[model samples]
Target chain A: MGQRIQSLRAGALDVAPILLGVVPFGLIYGVAATEAGLGSLSAFLMSSIVFAGAAQLVIVDLLAQNAAWPVILVTALVINLRMAMYGASLAPHFAHWSPWWKRVGAYLVTDQAFAVSIIRYEKPMAELPKRWYYFGAAVALWLVWQCSTMTGIALGATIPASWELDFAVPLTFMALLVPSIKDRNSMLAALGAGVAAALTSTMIFKLGIITSALIGVLVGYFAEGSER
Target chain B: MIASQSTGVWLLLGAVGVGTYLIRYSFIGILGRAEVSERVQRLLRYVPPAALAALVVPGLLFRGDNPGLTIHNYRLLAGLLAATVAWKTRSILATIATGMSALWLLQWLF
Candidate 1:
């Protein structure tokens, strides 16, 4: 029990900094959702239910444009496809967990939680206490996200359009993406997807994002293979 | 104000919620200890950069109103500046501060 508490505290502490960056994002999502004409209840529910920042934002964007349900669903799914990879990467660490524990853990999985937990899990002595650490980080992020979204919803139109809060979305992505471009294959992946998305930006129903992501992943995969 | 929810919006939200949960549960629940194939692993490694790049580039390069690349696109300039800060500092807070400030400054000056 002591060990569990210790791990949990460590997880929360580790993720505190990342949470600072995410607070503005959650707040922006709330403001954007309202501006997109989402029902306040629905906006709140989406945040609680989906709990995936980028996908939730995309849903609001598409819905506001009156995009079809199928298109919106597919676009959100494509944006979230990265979660499967995160799940796979973390599977080894979580293999021995009970079914109930795994379900809860999976629900709490976010990019921030996954990033912090994986680093802890990869350490040499990370066998038993890792789950608690994961929970700690996940729960911290969950609480912050929920509160910040509510704050944004409450503030609503008061945040002034002049602030251009919309830019926060791309800025957040750029911050996340730049750090991940460490190797040549990763760089190529980003470049390829970026160019594809730019070229296809005018495509109907926003299928361009899905296409560019697919092309980028394939390009990166082949690049990795060639290097070996 | 609570906007009336549409059936299509409800459907989209429901499907997204289910799909996202399943994606998160994929390997954690069903696959358990089984090792993922090397081929699949390699592909998964690129998911982050690919997906993020796809999301970011369009917003930076193409504003919805203007709908094309232009020298006056402050977002593109700010995003590039932020990317540089991200690479150099590797700090999320720093990147956001620099990007947002750069954007605000450019908007003011230009």
Candidate 2:
């Protein structure tokens, strides 16, 4: 019982900084959805249902452009393909959970939550359980997503650009990223990925990030330093 | 009977909701059933760092249409400050508090 509480608390705390970033993005999406001709209720429901930030925003952006429904659907799923990688990466930690909880765990696998939890998971086992920790992360993210989108829907995305709330997301990523680089392979992987992503940002449908991420993984996997 | 556009929007949402859920669940459901080889394990290990870096750099260095390599992009400057703090303190709280304060101050000044 004590371990479960500790795990949950840790998950929620680790996710808090990232949640600061989500607030603005969610607000932008909420404003985008309603402006795209979605009924506010449907837009809110999309937050509750579809749940992925970038994909949800893409769907709304395409709808605003009057793209065909099939094009929108396919594009959003392509954006979500990274989640499959996340699922694969996260499987080892979640392997011991019941099948239903595993599915729930997959549903909770946002970029921030996965990054925050996985780094800790890679460490030697502590007394805290992974499931409760993940659940706490999901719950914190879920509430903020719904509330922020709602605020944006009601308020029309009033968050000012001057505030630069978007920076927080990458800032949170930067914090999580540095610790992951321990040796030559990991260092090269990080460098290769940063350069590739910067170069390929012009790709259509935002495929650059995932593609560059894969390149970085291959670089690390085949790189000639394995002293870890 | 009216073919309202909201109906189409609802269809998009519902379809995407189902599609994304399955996409997320795909490997989680399948991979847990079998033990992966050491080769696959090593590959998975690199995914987090690579993915995080991939997500971070563009947001820091690039703007909407133009690259922000110059000093005018205050976010990049602030991000460098954040990275150093993260590397040094290794605390999430210290990273965010110090980084964001630097960002706000940077944006406020120049």
Candidate 3:
């Protein structure tokens, strides 16, 4: 019992900073969603249901434009395909946990939570109760996301769009991705994806982004393979 | 009527959701015990950067139907500069300030 308590406490401490970091992004999302014509209710619903930043942005952008629903859905899926990878990477760590716990953890998994949890889990430790750490991280991230989003929505109508606040979301992502580029294979993947996105995006009307991302993933995988 | 979206749209969303789930859960549900070949595992490592770059490049470069190359399209240049600064400095505050300033300055100048 003491061990479980300690693990939970440690997990909470670890996730506190990450949640704080996410607050601004969530608020921006709220502002963007509303600016893009998503109502407050819809913005809240989208955040809760989609539970991913990039995907929500794509969906709301489409919704604001009144794009075809098919396009919106496919775009959302393509954007979120990375979550599957996150899930696969995490499955082994939580394999021993019960089905319910696994399902809950899956629901909670996000790039940030997964990134922090995985790094901590990889460290050599004795009987650290992995699930508790994940839960704490997930819960902290989730709460901040909800609260920040609500704040955004509350301020969305009043906040002028002139600040170009929407751009901050992607900028935040760029900041996160810079530190992760450590090797050639990853660099090539990034290069391939960027070129593909640029080239294909103008080639056709739909699936340009999705196709580029899928191709990028395959290219990155193949690039890594060739190196090995 | 709530002016709700059409059923086709809903179904499409559902299908996409299911497909995403299949991709994400595949390793756990199907390949849990099976070992991926070393080669395949190596390939999977590159997915992150490639996928991310694919997402962001299009948004930054092309503005609505045209590939604007002028200095007027300073946001992209600024973003790249910020990205470079981020890579070298690993400072989030500096990156955000640089990128935001670039965009604001560009908009003001244009």
Candidate 4:
């Protein structure tokens, strides 16, 4: 227990870059939430309650458009499917953790937290402290996201939409995706998903986006398994 | 339809929060005893990249409600090109500059 706490403290020191990386994007999401018709408190509360940036952005946008409740619900579900994947990936590293601790960690799951935690987990198991490593990473990410998002909301109504900085959202996604495309199967999955999304846009309305994503992921998973 | 500042918006926000929590809770709660199948575990690996691309591609390629292939819609084309360059170069700065510049110049021209 002492070792885990100490490691968590040490891990906190290493999360500086992760916090920095998330700040601009969290700011952007805050700006978008306000623009999507959420008031300052609503924006603040959404960030805190959901604690998931992309899902919150989409939900706010959907609300702005007065989308149906079911549609909004499904969209949030599809966008957050990756969190389940993150949970599964971290299972082995966290297998020894108490159920209560694991539940808390699951609640704190975000892309930055997952990345840092997985990296720390994959290290030499004998030397690394998985419990504190995750605690430090998750806490650091959660705090930075909440702080930067609040900062964006505070600067709201004054920040010019002309900065046209929203484009960075997709750019950031591109940065994330490129690094993972190290093989044919992965490439196929991406291409399939993109094409499927494009085609789905033609019929059955917005559900196509989620459908395409789900299909592409399934294809990639099966392809990888077959090859193995 | 609720106005942006209306009480309805607050209600909508609350609903969204509840829904988001439900989705997260499902996986973490239900899967407690049941291990993820190997197949499901393998599939989860591809969800991030594929899903993100699915989100971005339509926004780039289509405008308002129209989906078309045309030289006039160079923002879409430029975005794809920029993504390709980023794929090859792995330069976030370059990719954004190239993609946004393409959109800016094209908007100016046409």
Candidate 5:
């Protein structure tokens, strides 16, 4: 129990800083969802159910635009494809766990949680403690996300339209995308994808974003391969 | 305004929820010990910047419902400023602040 507490405390403490960034993003999502014509109940529930910030934002925007359901689903799924990679990366570390525990752990996985837990797990550590730490970090983030999103939803109704809260959606994405462009390959990938999305913005069913993303990934892959 | 809660919206949300969970659970629950190839991992690394860029680019360039690119589009200019801040500070809060403030200022002036 003492060991569990220690690990849990460590996980929560480590995740605290990341929550600083998440809180604003969550709030923005709540506001955006409300502004985009999603019901308050739906806005709040989507945050709990979807729990993927970027995808949730996209869904709300697409819904507002009256995009078809398949378009919304495909776009969201494509945006979230990275989570599958995250699951794979964390698999080896969690291989020894029971199926039930693994299921619960998988639900807890988020970009921030994975980011913190992986760094902690990389160091030599026993399976049990590492798992406990993962839970700690994941749970902390989960709580912050839910609370901040709720706060945003509650405040959403009061926020005037003139505030242009909708712009927060793209601004948040900019904040997220800019830092990840650290190298030549990633830079070229972003440039390729961004231009594709802009040029194809008129495409039916919002295929532009997905196509752009695929092109970016392919470009980045070949660029990296050629370098090697 | 409570957007009309359509059965379609609920179904779409349900599908997204289930699909996202399955994606998250994929390797962790079922493929625990399976090794991913190096090529796939490299591709996954690019997903973040690429996907986010695709999402943001159109929003920055296009104003209102139209897809035209105009110099007077404050979002474009403000978004550029925000990107510069993000590049410099690597901070989410800073980026949002810079972008929103620039947007408001531009709107007021223009």
Candidate 6:
């Protein structure tokens, strides 16, 4: 139990600084929700229910435009398709946990939490009880997200568009991406994904991410085979 | 009635919430119990680089609807610089700080 608490604290500590980056975006989301005509309750509900920064922002943006419901749903789901990949990648680490906890754990699987947890788990440590670490990251992110969003909603529209805060998302991902490309095949995958994403970004319903990611995976796999 | 949003909006909320949860749960719930092959495992391992690249590139390339591919596209330039910083230092703070500052500076200049 003491070890579990320690792992949890470690997880939270690992993700704490990253959460600071998320707060500005979360506050921005709250303001966006209000401007989109969503009241405080629904705004808060969106934050808590969706618990996804990018997807929640997309939903609110669509709502403000009064886009078709199905459009909103498909677009949001496309944005979230990466969640499945994250879960699959992290599955081996938590294989010892019960099915119920796995379900709960999945709910907390944000990009940030998954990034930190997977790095921790991928290290060859035996019996480390890593789920607690994931829980710490996820729970910390959840609370900060909720509070910042509520604050943004309370403040409302005061966040100027001039800040270009949206750029933070890509900046964070770039930092994550560089370290992940640690090999030749992975390098090929990253390049393929970037060019493919840029080329196909004009696709309908925002299918570029999913499409490019698959292409990248295939390129990497095939490159590995070709090298052998 | 929830926050004066229309019933349609509530429906959207429900559909998105349930759909997203299922996506998050799918593999975590099943992949552990099932036997996995090495080939499939390799593909899964590639997910991080592929997915992150997909997310980062288009974001830097576009500003809203426009394709900001020109030299004037401050984000693309700043993103390139940040990518270099990330590669060299492997530091998230420096990458983001350099990227955001580069963007703000270029925008202020031009």
Please tell me which predicted candidate would have the highest lDDT against the true structure.
Answer: 5
Candidate 6 lDDT tens digits, A1-228: 888898889899999988877776777678777767787787888887888887787677656655557867876776676687788787878778888888899899998899888888877655556778888899998999999989988977565667775676677678778988999999998899889999987776666667888898888988888987
Q: By DockQ thresholds, what CAPRI class is model 6?
A: medium
Give candidate 4's whole-model lDDT: 0.70
Candidates ranked by DockQ: 5, 1, 6, 3, 4, 2
lDDT of 3 by residue, A1-228 (tens): 787777766777887766655776677778877787665776786666667776766665556555666767777776666676677678778777767676667777787778877898898655447877777778878878889888988998997867876666567657666765678767777777778887786554456666776676677677766765
Against the true structure, what is model 3's DockQ?
0.45
**Model 2 iRMSD vs. native:** 5.9
TM-score of 3: 0.85
List candidate 3 stretches off by more than 4 Å: A65-67, A124-128, B1-31, B36-44, B64-67, B89-94
In model 3, the clashing pairs are A84-B24, A189-B50
- A130-192: candidate 2 lDDT, tens digit per residue: 788888888889889999989978865555555655455566567668887888888888888
Candidate 5 docking category? Answer: medium
Ten-residue region with minimum lDDT total, candidate 1 chain B? B1-10
In candidate 1, stretches whose alpha carbon ends up further than 4 angstroms from where it belongs are A124-128, B1-5
- TM-score for the second chain in candidate 3? 0.70
Scored by TM-score, the top model is: 5
Give the DockQ of candidate 2: 0.41
Error of 1 at A28 (Å): 1.8
What are the per-model DockQ values?
A: 0.64, 0.41, 0.45, 0.45, 0.73, 0.50
lDDT of 5 by residue, B6-103 (tens): 56677888899999999999889877787878877899899988999999998887636533577778898899999999999988889999999999
Of all native A–B interface contacts, model 6 reproduces a fraction of 0.69
Candidate 5, A36: how far from true, in Å?
A: 1.5
**Please, what's the RMSD in Å of model 1?**
2.3
lDDT of 5 at A156: 84
| Residue A85 miss distance in model 3 (angstroms) | 2.7
Q: Judge candidate 6 at residue A24 and give its lDDT.
A: 68
Model 3 C-alpha lDDT per residue in residues B24-50, reported as the tens digit of each score: 556655566466565555555655566
- Alpha-carbon shift of residue A219 in model 3 (angstroms): 3.0
lDDT string, candidate 2, B2-63, tens digits: 11466777888888989999978877887565655677667766766776787778778774
| Model 1 lDDT per residue over B5-107, tens place | 5665676688889999999999999989788798888887888899889888987887556436777888888888998998898776787788889989998
